[model samples]
Structures are given as C-alpha cells and as structure tokens.
Target: MSYPRLAGKRILVTEADAFMGPMLCQVLARHGAEVIADAGTLADDPQRPAAIVAAAGTIDVLVANLAIPAPSTPAVEVSEAEWRATFAALVDPLPRLVGAVLPQMLARRSGKILLMGSASALRGMRRASTYSAARGAQLAYIQAVGVEVAPYNVQVNAIAQNFVDNPTYFPPEVQADPRFQDRLRREVPLGRLVTAGEDAEFAAFLASDAADHFVGQVFPVCGGWVGR
Candidate 1:
C-alpha cells in the first residue's frame, strides 16, 4: 500500500467526483501522494486545464479523468452535436492539460501523465459510436504525446479500461440486475467486474517512479475483456 516513490508527490486528478476519481485520490493518498482532487468541469472552457495546473502549482502527475455519458444512439442516428460534444468532453482537454503541466514536468524532467480512458477505443461496442470515437482519440493522443514527452523523462500513458465498478459506468443497481450479471459473465472473461480499488491501484503504480520505463503505452485494464 506504501509507495515511497509517490510519497510527497503532487498529483492532480480532474473530475475528482466521478469515474475512478474518488478511489484514485484515496489510493494515491494512502500511498503517500499529495492528491489534488479537482471535481470540476473542463470542457466548459478550454483554458480550464491550464488554470487548474496553475492553481495546483507544482504537479508531479496529472490524471486526466475525463468522462461523459456514453451515447446509445445508433451510428446513423448519431448527430453532429453529439459527436462534437463527446469529443469536447473527452478528447479536447487532453492536450490542454498536457500543455499546462508539461512545462513544469519538462523543466524538472520528471513527471507522469495518466489518462483514464475507455476500452471502447480498443474494441467495438454496440451503440457507442460517438463515445468510441472520442475514446479512440484519447488513446491516439496519449501514444503520440507519450513518446514526445519521453525525451524529457516525462512519461505519458493511458489505462484503456471498461467493465470496472464505477458509478459512471457500472453502478450497484446495474450490477444487481440479473440480465447485466448474465451479460457480464458472458462478455468479461474474468466473469466479474474489476473493482475501482484495483483499477486505482494500477493507476497509483503508473504514477510512481517504478513506471519510469513506460512510454506511449495504452494499457488495457478491463480484465480479459480487452487485449492487444
């Protein structure tokens, strides 16, 4: 539970009230990180990311915890508004966040940037065209920027995940439903949901010095549901 490498580390997690935010903050703090949990909206203003970084001051790690409700509209019915909105919520802020934080990290030549992304980008899902596209954009951005930042020893990576127990995706009510449980067993090779704590632990590891060798990696954390 203790990560000396993360002890005294300053980490900023966006949307801290949703989608792995609370658990991430709790785990990182338990491991001795100075977690700045920002439960705020970013897409409302392109400048919000930079403002957050400035407010948080010295950031050793940035967890871009972005999320929007997945659209269930069929591909043909997916409107331009939905598509643009999804990207605005999920894709646009990534560069802004990195732009805001990279200078400090690059100056020190040490920092971690971890994106909380979705496996829908890695695999196809029914009724998720807009969400999948946005998630895919996030993965691509991470891969490209991860390498770009590596020369400065600032690692960038993403946790491409789904089927995790989180309020944003799978809530207790959904888990308790028999149909969802049956589908979960059929779909997820693990035969159960990955706990938020487990996912947060992985995020904590990635933020620690132990993950220095990783760069441009889109790690799939959806149990056996997503691979390669």
Candidate 2:
C-alpha cells in the first residue's frame, strides 16, 4: 500500500509542465522521493537529456513522457515532412534519454525507467494516426531495450494511458462538451476519465521495488478502454 515510499530517492521527469508530469512529481515527492523536474519536451530547442543531464547528477529513475500530435486528417492527407517531424518528436527523444542514462544504471545495477506511452498503441486512434504510429514504434523499442537492461538490474516499462482529463493533452472545448464527454463515458467501463494523480501513483510503484516483477511490460493504465 505504501509503495512510493521513495524517501531520499532521486527521480528525473521530462515535460515537467505538462498535464501529468508535475502532478506526478508531487506524488513522487509525497512518497519521500527527491523529484527533479525541468523543461524537457522532445520538441524543445535543446532535447530532454540535454536539460536533464545538466540539471543534476546521474538519475536513479527517469520518466520519459513526450508526444507530438500530428494534424488531424486522413493518413493520405498527411505530408512527408510533417510525418518525419512527428516521428522524431514523439518516438525518438525518449529512447535517446534512456540510452544515455541506462548504461550508468546498469553499471550500478539498480534503476527504474518508466516511459509514457498511450492506449493508441493497441489500435490506432481515429485521426491521430501519427501519434499512434510513433507510440507503436516506442512500444517495440522499450520492449527490446527492457530485455537487454533487465539482466543488468535495470527495469524498463511503458504505461499506456487512455483518455485522462487534462488541458494540455485535451482541448478545453472537448473537455467541457457534454456530448463528447458522454461518448467517452460510454466507451470506458469506468464511465469516467483517468486522473493524473492515479496514473502517477501507479508509475511511482513501477519505479519502486513494488514493481520488481514488471519488466518489458506494457501496463495499461486505461480504464478498460483498450480491452474488453
């Protein structure tokens, strides 16, 4: 029950200002972890690792949460240039950051890396094909690297969240629209949106010994949206 219990542990989180990141940091600190958050959006001028590496010493945990939503339109309507940028912004940076710190952790033989993924990886989201595709690639990458790092006492896993009620990821119009809300309410068995704090708590557990058995896994944090 008291999982996070991350007292004195140092954790690094990217996209600290996003809907879920800061909230997650608070939860980590509440569990006694020393949270270090900085501006590390994959789209930022200087990437995540650059900022994170500069913030402090080597990290005990890393949370990679970056996403780039391509323009909503048919896949046939998307341009090549736009698609390339989306792939880089969504799929590339997280791995680079992980690769950067993973060796250090492996050498020490103790670390947890929780990368943020989406339920869209299960099946593509209607208009957000690019985001889905990028995440799919991310899912594959995490699995491979997770296997390689597990032997070194490093843990890697992805958390796939469905539709969480957050302004940064969801538009204000959509958030307040009762028609759209009712539609999603019917889709998810929980009949409501996933809260960031709840997701953070689960993530904190993954970052702790509580989730030692969770390796190379895609833990669906969605409220039955990606399953029956």
Candidate 3:
C-alpha cells in the first residue's frame, strides 16, 4: 500500500548532519517520503551503507547540497592549489554520487535532482570569487544535465537562494558580522532571510509528480535579491 503523498518515494539527501540536511529529511519523511539519510559524505567516509546510489537502491530523488570553502583567503590572495582544491571539493564528488543512480533513473524514466545553489552564483560577488565560480559552474552543469535527462523524464534543476537561517553550512565569520545582515536586508526585498523549511517544501514539490514540466530550470528562491 503506497501512500499517494510520498509514501514509498525514496529521497536521498547529502550533508545530512547539516541544519537543512537533517531538517529536510525529517520533514520529507513526515510527509510520507521514504527518506534515505545519506550522511556519509559529511564524514568523508567512503564506505557508508548509503554512500553511493547503487547501495541505496533506485533513488527516486537526489538533493545535492554539499558545500566547501575556498583554500585562498581572498580571490586575489588565493593560490592555484587552493582554487583547485576548492573546485575539487565542490565539484568532483557530485559525479561520483549522481553517476551511481542517474543510470537507474534513466532506466526507470523518472527521477529528480535538486541542487542547493546560491544567489551569488547567478550574479557574481566581490569577495566570493572561488565560491561563486564553483556555484556558477554548478548551475551550468544543472542546465546541461537537465537537458540531457529530459528525454528520460528525469528533471535536473537548482534552487538558487541568498540567505537561509539554517546555520549548519553558514560560515561562522559571516554569522557574527552584522554588516552582511544589513546588506542582506537591503538587497533582499523580503526584508528577512529565507527559511529552511521553505526550501525543503519547494524541494518536496520538485520531487513530486507535479513538477513533471520542470527541467533545466534554475529556480531562484532568493527573496527578490537576484531578480532586480
């Protein structure tokens, strides 16, 4: 007996120990989605039970929300080695994770991939060269992959956001500084930071049957920050 609202849907979330990761998993699970806690990536553990897609069986949905810091202190001050490491950490593992289940999704002709991106990537930032570069590249990847899998009924899309209260992935320095908050309030028309559950809610919708028409879409949930 499958539940219509997401009873048997298998959802795999990365960075599970982080604020949004675990929180989204629980929310999805409560909504009837069969949530798979893919927390191994956070530990850098290459051998967790659900470390790879094959191990977790056919995943109905995959949410990749991993983040890494740039090696260089500033864009100008950052070294080549640090840049490479930053991209390596930010981009390299995705193929490994998605590659494992993408084939199966193609075979099944239905699946969804949600990426947690940032608004800075949509519009470049001054000090976030490394991070924004990686995120921009990720957005491009989402577009390409979305088109590639569209024929198979697989949707690949990204959610570009500015501020979510979820602090697990937030850099400590930024949290402590009020200047960033002021700027955020000024730039963001909503006048408040984004909420984690809102993101999870949108993700749930994208993963559901209702979002069949969505593909190659970089949905910006940035509270009007990037729209202007």
Q: 2 or 3, which is superior by TM-score?
A: 2
- Off-target runs (Cα >4 Å) in candidate 1 are 226-228
Off by over 4 Å in 3: 1-4, 40-51, 69-72, 169-177, 226-228
Candidate whose TM-score is highest: 1
TM-score of each: 0.97, 0.91, 0.86
Q: What tens-digit string does per-residue lDDT give for candidate 1 at 1-228?
A: 664558989999999999899899999999989999999768889988989899999999999999988899999999999999999999999999999999999999999999999999988788899999999999999999999989999999999999998998887888999999998788889999899999999999999998999999999988686233
Q: RMSD in Å for candidate 3, one decimal?
A: 3.4
Query: lDDT for every model?
Result: 0.92, 0.78, 0.74
The TM-score of predicted model 3 comes to 0.86
The candidate with the higher lDDT, 1 or 2, is 1
Error of 3 at 102 (Å): 1.0
Q: Point out the higher-scoring one by lDDT: 1 or 3.
A: 1
Q: What digit string (tens of lDDT, one per residue) describes model 3 on residues 1-228?
A: 223466689998877766468767967887799887766443244343235666678799888877664333666787787677667656666666667678889999989988877666878566678878877888888899999999999998988876776765455677667997787777878866677778778777777888889998998886776344
Clashing pairs in 2: none
